[model samples]
Target: MERDPPLVLDIDGTLTRPEGWGIDPRLFDPLLEWEAPVVIATGKAFPYPVALCHFAGIPELVVAENGGAVYTGDDVFFTADRDAAEAVAREYEAAGYSLGWGPEDTVNRWRETEIAVQHDQPVEPLREIADGYGLEVVDTGYAYHVKDPAPNKGDGVRTIAEHTNLDLEEAVAVGDSENDVSTFEVVGRSFAVGNADDAARGAADEVLEDVHADATLGVIERVRSA
Candidate 1:
């Protein structure tokens, strides 16, 4: 029998239901029993995806902080310029805008390579400031991430693929936002969930009718039956 292709998934809006912030319970068993490696790629911090993989009983393959960090189970490495990201964050703060979280903000407490600002904050200004510092701002729908321009989900997935000895051209990826576009570009086939933003939909090879985790499950089913 032919082996299944490696799968790369986005966590937040792709794995979670539209009404909730957590992963849909429906995804647990399928992911846990998947024959091929599953990589969780997200704009979320490093620890979040790592923890999710740990509890899900999946390998700790991750592309976190929008590709600023990559964990290949045996080793972990960072690509984005943390110092540049921090400088942008500091400047953003000085411009009289709140980072959108409190002093004890858990949103960015563990973030190493990028800064995540709440969505409600003005994004244009953040983008301008990031550009001045030779950085970029990506809106993930949930938040605006200020980080290095070079490191993106594509780079992260490539790193994961390389370490796992998987063929990048045969991998499949699924996601629902702009941050996922990079991954879409790198994978052999990519799916954008029904609720995906325009950029993701445009980048993906196919746009699914189902939304969120349902779409992800559908993709898995499609791949399995192929």
Candidate 2:
């Protein structure tokens, strides 16, 4: 059998149901114990995914802040234009939407490349504002991220693949949201969890019937068997 490719997983809707860090410890135990190159790709900022990796015993690199930062061990590399992101955040704040920049609650505050805000607020206006700054507003099912359009989960996966000496053709990506669509485009194979949004399902190569972690577990088994 061919060697299993690197597996890239989105944290929010793919690892667990969409909520704030609502993952069950047991859900990822098997993945953590597996001897393979695994990465946590999330729209969340640094230290959040970093902290999760530590807690989950996942020792590989992390793609955080919606592909703005790639965390490899103790070092982190940025991939977005920070000044543009800052301007976008300021624009939101000036428009009466709180920036959500607190260190404790605002994971985006810790990010270097992207600004994440509560998606519950008005989005099209924010998108218009972000577009003015040559940025795109991505709704990651958990938050609205103002970022450079080019850097996404796909770019993050490419970074991890290069860093780990793996080919992009030898990778599988699993996700369940609109932001994950970029990831679906970059990998050789993409699996959309049953709970995935329409855009995500449309972008994926295969759509699994199970939802959330269940779908992720099934993908893992498929990869192992392949």
Tens-place lDDT digits, model 1, residues 49-125: 99999999999999999999999998898996578888888988998998988899898899989999999999998
TM-score of 1: 0.96
**What tens-digit string does per-residue lDDT give for candidate 2 at 62-137?**
9887788887665677887678978877887788877554546556556778777786678887899999999998
In model 2, where do residues sit more than 4 Å from their true spots?
1-4, 17-21, 100-104
Best-performing candidate as measured by lDDT: 1
Model 1 local distance difference test score:
0.90
What are the models' TM-scores? 0.96, 0.88
Which 10-residue window in model 2 sums to the lowest lDDT?
17-26
Q: Which of the numbered candidates is closest to the native, going by highest TM-score?
A: 1
Model 2 clash pairs are none
Worst 10 residues of 1 by lDDT: 17-26
Cα displacement (Å) at residue 4, model 2: 4.2
